[model samples]
Target: MTNLTQARLFRHENLPFLLAALLLALLAGCAGGPAPAPQATPSAEEAQQTEALEKMVRQGRHLDAALAYSRLANRAAPPLREMYSLRAAELLKDGNYIPQSFQLLSEIQGANLGPEFHIRRVLLTADIALARQRPDEALAVLDSITSQLADDERDFRRRYHQLRAQAFEQLGQPLESAREHVLLEPLLDDPAAVQANQFAIVDELQQLTPQVLDGLAADEFGGWLALAAIGKGVDDSLPADELIARWRAQYPQHPASEATIARLLAARPQALRTPRRIALILPLGPRNRYAKAAEAVRNGFFAAYYARPRQAMADAVPGDGGAPHLEDAGSNAPPLQLRIYEEGRGAEAFDAVYQQAVADGADLVVGPLGKDAVSRLASRESLPVPVLALNYGEMNGAPPRNLFQLGLSPEQEAREVAQRAWLDGHRRTAVITPSTPWGDRVAKAFNERWLALGGHVVEVQHYDPKKNDYSLPIRRLLNVDESQARRKSVRRIIGEKIEFIPRRRQDIDAIFMVAFSRQARVIRPQLRFHHAPKVPVYTTSHAFSGTVDPQMDRDMDGVMFADMPWTLAPDALGQRLKGDIARAWPGAARRYTRLHALGVDAYRVIGQLNELRRDRAAHFAGETGELSLDADNRLQRRLLWARFQRGVPQLDTTEN
Candidate 1:
């Protein structure tokens, strides 16, 4: 139904409750002894104070504003006092002072308060319960207040339904949550907010499986379910736009706006042109610096290619323009024809090979493994064919059109570390990384993300990775050297020996270290010796060797890092691939596990790049990580996190 009709129905249905709420407000006003005060409400002095407190809130001083509100409540009378107290409790809750907010809300009693105050108090109680992770309690409180809401209370009704939806989401009831959002869509006034609610509805409904969608009851949210089911047809032979058109024909009166429909069609994952002739380009010449790494990637690409279903290959179509096709009795060749092009040691050679591959009918190109090679390709505005570069290139802003980058990026891992540390309640941190270009990039990524999250980098020290002893950098990073200098100054002034222990800086709650396992083994022990044994350490995947060796890795205890599932906890497909690689090429399987996984993902991503690029929620479960594409056409990997405990990297179940 249309939003206007829905809103009118809502108001009509709650007519009795509205009249009762009005009576209660009138009675409360009479009992409190002044209708003049209700008209005047906040006096001039209270207005000034409230304006000042609002200024503090605007400046992010939530605690200060809350305290000011509490003090104002103490000096105010009757309903004003309770209103001020409710505002204070809301500010406290927004500032993450959950227990204080809860206690303040509990103390508030709505005896002779107006309808607004009564609704605020009830909503505040439910909000605090939600903040405390007590979704069941929050839902119960909301249920008790649901029927008491009046027709005129549009804002309160919005908040009430929003809280109910959140509580349902917390309880793993996405269908129920979606229904609540569908109900709330008509109440939203802002265009952006309405679009967000629409997307949220689709996201919740998308969580349900096809079986659930098929068996869904034709109730109030049937149009919503139907829309979500159409969106989920990414792999369907029928185009997604056509499916959406069919849905629009069926549910024209549904609440989903025109903008939302446009967005759905834009991001719809229709069947992209499948490249029958695929070109794999890499710096694989013997003299190339990245020859061995390229070899590992090549092996991985072929492994994934060969793993495709035999029947699918047997039923292959011809290439572009109905070119002739070839098949052997037992060759087990991929349906898509594959060719490897050797990207020689120079950029000039790479260009020549890339052109040759295109001339040879290469519809899709996946390679140019070197950064410089990828950068050369990225400089172009467009390419004759799509190129999935193995390494990210330097781009001033967004990536070039038709070019995608996917690699084991340390910068991505560093950013993940920043987010993980913030989630773990760390606000201040120190970083110790290698004094090299790669370390600088990783450190810059961490600092940018950390600062964006309102975290502070107390100190950032660079260490020489070649040096086995990291005492100097560690001491500098912890400010232990400064502490020792102070102790020496005290001893010299007293003209006698002084018993003192050098104290490390107390401001930092976490340490972000960028190092390989060898460097980390030394760094972790030195950090303990320097009196930082309890401080948490976070790092990139470089800190783990990807192979388990308890005796060697015992020194890595308590260090948390993010790595691909293939290295940490391989799934059945990954295990099978790992075994196949090990038997075929043991060295690449053992020594270059991560690169091998990257290669496998590169092949898998080739087919899904269109979907990943258009749809933000689309993902491919590959050997590398849960692969998705960012706006820049760069493939982003959400790696699994693990903590080293007694030399074994345990998958953090908290994340699961």
Candidate 2:
């Protein structure tokens, strides 16, 4: 009893102290224990998955990587989820899955993300707008957020500059585009990337003319201006290597790599050999079938020849057993001798005339207009002298040596029409061609080029070009016959007739009609009557006669075709020639305008052939078109586009 009483007193006295010591022990334990194992972070497995997905992106398996990132985003939390979503959208856009990427991008709210991710979202949106060819929208979106980006964010800044540059390029602002590339170059670390950016800068600068270039600050672009000026100043005489050496000495610290300089040097036009004597052979004799056409060509040739002061004719004198030789008068350039030889129709006749021209000391022979004659000259294993044939040869293999062909081939125009329609965003097309050889050639060329561009020819219908009526072909092309037949079947099934309008096939986005104006005028209206008025009609130059007769061409409205600048918007030289011809040869000016242009171009090309031959990129601004020489030595043309509105052809300013 005494021990129990003592223990009770001890317990009562120590109760408060024991309680305090226990509470202090509990607090110390709580503070010292390993901090609550940091709330579940991205697991090792998730990190590994991220690395693998990034690896896919590096390997260029963008779609696969994008889909994987989406899966990860679905399972991840805030910030991380937003980041993965942004990444997925980027890859999809890069891979050209625009609609799907935009849809995914719409699902992610950028406001909730961090500064970096929000910027990424904005860039992706702008990029998609650019892909859809809406540069204005892209530029607006970028301009709004440009101030928010920090200067030190090199990667984001680089992308921002690139998108801005591309937007400017699409909007036809080359100078602005080049400025962005110039800014982007310094931010790029990789050597190849830097080189590419430099080239892009030069390319944009090249689009500017010398007059335009003069207005720009030379020092601002780090020698890009000097480089482009050197490119533009290149002539037929100055050696490109020498120019390059001078450029190097002038700007030793320029950023353009040696590779870029080398490429420019390779593309430079080589020195040309101006012929002292030129012989023109054509069927110009009175009895020749092409005499009238040949005379028109001869007039055009002389017009171009006399236009140059270096070749002023003294007087015509009869040569020894050949055509008359016209000697050049006193001029700065060396005296030139021009001789005209009358050609016969057949290849053998062309051979005789060609032999005579070459024997007559002709340094260059330009002529023999018939296709067969050109083919004959082209078939020869070797020619004694260079000949720029006026017609293209039907060669089964590589083009012959020393023979350059330049002609207003319908095939070239057909290919250009296909290109124009393709660029206009047309994919599916129906072709209606005249049942003729020329029509077949044009249609074949269009089909070959259109298909090569990954376009589809839904249906091709050949119509009788001679007949004025194009109902059958038009109906077949639009599938109106099928629609009408279905209506009839439905009426029979219901034992009654109902009011109906024939419906054309909804799949075709365009129509490629190979017809002359007479045929096209009738066909276009029939197309409208067949319920396909809005479908864009694309054609070759044949659809528009060289003269403007809006009253007659009114029915040919809304038709787009590719034609020569001489017929569309001739420059000062062309206008002068037109005026002169109108006063001198009014009838020929109206009747054979295109043929006259052809002759003028033929004469102009003789001096330019060497430049075109040496450099594939060199162009001659001829009356025919923007002329360039193909690998086959065939002169190809980039024609201007024109659309008929209320019967008159208006030049399309959007050809570029």
Candidate 3:
């Protein structure tokens, strides 16, 4: 059958009343009465009044137009009273003047009107009450209409039940909402309402018991899964395995069956055989500046691996302190460090590392710390064991399947800042960035995320880092249009009538400045002088990377920025790693805590690759806070926001 025919058949079985109403309306319109004779001329006064009302309605001045129409209609013949009442009803749909509209309708004795008119009045009053948030009043209006409503009003009744359910839900009466759901049960089978009912059932399950969900039919499993996934504070204590088994047995062919099975299977532990050896590569030479840093990171990684309980590694590593074979990427030799296992760049490095690991019977490969080394190793086509890139790397066109990059980046910080601003309800923002490549990178990421959230970028102003004056760019960004008189007064007060007016602070709601310490110090005070201190300010990670002097702190009060969470908490793992690093080199903990934490997490995940890949969310909450692998295989971290308070970066809140 054709789609329209199939739709008609479905509706006949699902919403018969709706179909009947449409048919009735169509038939009534088709059977027309004799046309009235054309009038000689239209009333000039009436036409003028209608034109004015039309203008008011077009301008969204509903109240003014309603009053104007009522006055004109009242002064005309008795037949015009219906026209005035209709116009008044249209205006009253705004809900602001519901009570007033009801009073007007009552004064006109609407109960004595025709059946259609009475029905319209009742619906209008109920809608007004609902808009005014008076659920009880709306219910009373609908109740009064039910006794007198004709048989043709079944479709209206269905709508009334739906509206009643919403009102009861809003009023926190779940029982009443459930009762309305029962009333809508027939409509639930309608394809148009199926998805909507699914959503509603999921919402209801938040307050319902497992017994209630179990009692539902097999067809309702999809709705239950959707509910379980999205419902707030849903109790997950019920065993997922058991639930999946029951669902599979009851509805083997359900649409969501495969996905549900996958989720259940992932929750189970996978059997993995222990391998003989593991390969560890690090840059270990005298000439490299990061040679000390690299050693510290390697120590952190070992500390994390050994920190796991003895039973956890019984299968993976043989003894209590099973040592992995270490390789050195050499001294003052870029190619040696960049090339993994004496191989050239690209897949050769990956192949060499994999072959060496396999030759030693290793289960995993860790590191090749530098970005170049990582890029070269990751360019390989295949590997015998999973390689965890210890340091950050450019993923190039695509990231390696078996390799994972774990490190902090500027793009991550910018995205976090923009997301935080959006969640805080700042819909309009301006970006002030340095005219540098790094500055552009931060600005681009921030702009992309902000725009993705349906926010508007009012201005993107770039300032030359080498230049001193930023007032013009700031003013242009703020779109400051100073009043002529105020400008003249300010100019006279300063004893110089300058042509350029400085930007005012109140113009933009939020400002994102992408600059380091020195530029931040200059721009922040300028923002305050322009009366923009009240506006919330965001900056990149670079803001906290530099020295914060007394003057800088004074200027940057209340400014917030995103950085790795280790900066604040530096968890148990982080502290242990820091202590290990400190034992090797004093005062190193304070400077390299972030990189140390990164190294520890990278090591832990490499050992538990199966679990990490199986449950991505569980891999999150490490020393560096939440971390997830996006579609691109790049690790996305949940950064924390810190405010500059008393010359220190303090944890603001757990908002982002």
Candidate 4:
């Protein structure tokens, strides 16, 4: 009846005792009249139906049992009929017959069932409503039954709060959703699970004002808030040190208070599941769409494998110049036997290649770099080996545990830019991007993330890639054209000129630009010319080419962006690698230089994948970015922040 009693009754050691108690309850309800007088026998039809009901229940035919129970309810006394209807409703609910379950419960709505059954019926009814995407109806039902649940009936009490939480989420009421989790905390038994749930709630509350979180931390959800303060992946609105101090002052007795702070400085989890043999699948044809990219990646992977840590090769300058390069490995780190296979012949051939890779003793498969190849692999029943798919596959249900999707997606970069902007105190922003599919995708991703974070997109301007002068879009983005129109109209009305300064909209504090190095050079100065100087401009890695011509790029002196460490890490490790790339591939294209960095990370990641998967604090600072695995199991890279100063991209060491 009570939470403790229910827990004790259902515990493994008490399961037999529980079954005996259930037997007595069932017997007390069904055992016939007083023993002094002989009881009257039921009709033969009733006897046959009762036997059939027992048989259906025993055979695990729940739907059939529900049907038989419904028939029996028709002939039973009022109290018996209520019991029969409740039994049928439970069976239908368990069997996922939502319509039937709700119908049966509705039939018994007037049967005068007590608080326990009433609460269960209400919960089920609301659950069915939510399953049908009717959150408003669910909320109404949940509201009507509020007084029925008590601490004694913790089963339904727990479930009631869960339904309310989900309903509020569907209804887009975040505080209410968090309130349910707060209500749920005391009902849970395991501390880890409770902390995990609270962290999840914190994730949903990322955009909430600090005042709201502080109030909650001091009140009903103190422990939950404290745990959330230490939770992984949270976007902290307050400084971490200040937030932890506030939480401690609010709740001094909470464990993990100081210990949680220590984890932030600890190293990432070690690789516990590294594969000995790896399969490298690339489209090797000269004409393949990603052939060159794949080659660069492959070369980069091997260079990383051999570029032993602490070796001078990591810092050596390329013979050609100080360009990005992958130095050859000489040190004796036992190499992962890489088995290469040809792909890109056709999409249908991917499965065969994958199967062959497994047969060739590959414990880990790196990729089928083509998008179509990854899609085909995803559609399969399962992957035989742990796969680090080069490109993202179509998401259909939970992907195989072995499947990991990694890509240099423009969309990923855009989303990160939005998050960084929000963390940096930018609320009203404008977007300046090129007029192409890639540009459209990045802009859309930024807008989506920004809007979801409660920020506004003031304007989005698309410009032609070939255009050198972006004055028109600049004028529109800054509201200068409108300012000019107003000035002209005022001049005409007064028949004389008055002192006028073009006013850009005051709402925007940040501008997100998605452009290549050339376009960035042209647009950065144009943005300053249109009275938007001093407003922070954000861009992707596109803002900086691997090579820098300070004279040519001085116009982009203040733009910040996320870029790989291969080009911008500034330390000796980066310089050495850059020298390697320049000497190894003397004529390497500037843009493709990062691919070599990608290859380096790809090889480095195999050893660290287990670390990322298991430890929330763990991340791999590869050539691509700061890499971590997300809830969706996708490998996400949060790029290093850099600002161009005098044609060189320096790390933005300022706090976000």
Highest lDDT model number:
1
Superior by lDDT: candidate 3 or candidate 4: 4
In model 4, the worst 10-residue window by lDDT is: 1-10
Count of clashes, each model: 0, 0, 2, 5
lDDT of 2 by residue, 1-656 (tens): 00001111223212211211112222233344454442235669889998998897777556567756776765665566667777887887665445556666776654955677778888999997886677999999998778988889998999999999999999999899998998897889876566456657877887877777777654555378667656545453667677778778877877776876765544432323577778888887777788777777766776666556654433322232133112332352235767788887687888988888888888788888889988877777878788888888888676556788988899988887886676565779999999999899999999998886568999999999889899998899999999999999999999997999889999999999999878988999999999998999999888887889989998888898888878887878888666655665677787788878888888888888865865564568788887878777899877777789999998664311
Error of 4 at 282 (Å): 1.7
- Summed over model 4, clashes come to 5
How many residue pairs clash in model 2?
A: 0
The candidate maximizing TM-score is 1
Error of 1 at 217 (Å): 22
Regions of candidate 3 where Cα sits further than 4 Å from its true position: 1-276, 283-296, 306-354, 370-381, 391-401, 463-501, 505-507, 546-552, 654-656
For model 4, residues 549-633, the per-residue Cα lDDT tens digits are: 7888888888878876676663455566556666777666365788877777777787777657654434566667767776445
Model 1 agreement with the true structure over 414-507: per-residue lDDT tens digits: 9878877865657799999999999999999999988876689999999999989999999999999999999989988999998899899999
Q: What is the model-wide C-alpha lDDT for candidate 4? A: 0.68
Model 1 misplacement above 4 A? 1-271, 312-333, 346-348
Model 1 TM: 0.63
Task: Give Cα distance to truth, residue 116, candidate 4, Å.
Answer: 34
Show model 4 residue runs off by greater than 4 Å.
Answer: 1-273, 309-333, 497-500, 570-574
Query: Each model's TM-score?
Result: 0.63, 0.60, 0.50, 0.56
Task: Please give the range of 10 consecutive residues that has the lowest summed lDDT in model 3.
Answer: 1-10
Return the lDDT, model 3, position 299.
55
